[model samples]
Target: MKKTLLALLFGSSLVLAACGDNASDEASDANNPQDAAESAAGTEIEPEKIVNQKCSSCHGGDLSGGMGPALKNIGSQLSEDEILSVIQNGKGAMPKNIIEGDEAEAVAEWLAEKK
Candidate 1:
């Protein structure tokens, strides 16, 4: 299920990128995962550091749950896209944009692998 969703998103992104003005650049980006990710977010980010610095305090030092919900198995409950949305938009008592841009994308992708 996770693979299927990731493949779908990846395929969709490639298609969208291909539809842009610079087809050569887009096509190359489609063939390069690192490039695609960087373009999608702006730059490469260290998610673990971000999580430790920003999320550990609220979610628990071990991420087992503290002021916020347990994130140990967050991917079982939310997809990367859904997690990104929550990170960007906030939920319940969570505030928006605790992290933004590439940092947020990196964190979402990492957390979505917990399952």
Candidate 2:
């Protein structure tokens, strides 16, 4: 009877240990911003960085316009969807697909907030 009790206690301990590990993993995942953003509902692409890397060449570092028209207050001129379309499809003098996928959406979202 003592041996049986010991075995049961050992099994219970192992189960609890496994559960604790899972909980710890979940907590760590929750703490990670990228993981949380990816796991949650919306995409979390960084638009300002994208602009600096890609659009800054044409739009200017300050987005006040260079080769391309000033993007400042572009939100007032175009809706979010329109901005996304332009980024994906491109406008005159702007190359098509200058940005794509989540990057395009991120840029559009960022530009939309410029108003």
Candidate 3:
């Protein structure tokens, strides 16, 4: 009887462990930024698209500078945090709060990786 009880308990514990693993996997999927963005936008959010839509007018189509300063090598000129701050808050002739939230974060991350 004791052996049967032990087997049952062990089986229950294994089932519980499997359940926990599945829950964690679901939670991680939910937390994925790209997945969240795609759900919200009904499509994937491309960082380059955001840049082109919002920045291309002044920065030029290729980010090689036009009315705004060149951004082709901005990654070497500024840290990611600095770039994010400048993007969020604006600097010089740039208007403030041009981008915000996740889109801003994605753009900043993309630009910071240009180097």
TM-score quality measure for candidate 1: 0.62
Q: In angstroms, how far off is 95's CA in candidate 1?
A: 0.3
TM-score result, candidate 3: 0.63
Give candidate 2's error at residue 38 in angstroms: 11
- Give stretches of model 3 more than 4 Å off: 1-43
Per-model clash counts, in order, read 0, 0, 0
Residue-level lDDT tens digits of model 3 in 42-98: 565588987886787678889999868999989999888899999877888676667
Error of 1 at 33 (Å): 31
Worst 10 residues of 3 by lDDT: 14-23
- Per-residue error for 66 in candidate 1, Å, reads 0.4
Tens-place lDDT per residue, model 1, 32-89, is: 9889988887565789877886777668877898768999999999999999999999
| Candidate with more favorable, higher lDDT: 1 or 3 | 1
Candidate 2 residue pairs that clash: none
Give the Cα RMSD of candidate 3. Answer: 20.1
Better of 1 and 3 by TM-score: 3
Q: List runs of model 2 lying over 4 Å from the truth.
A: 1-43
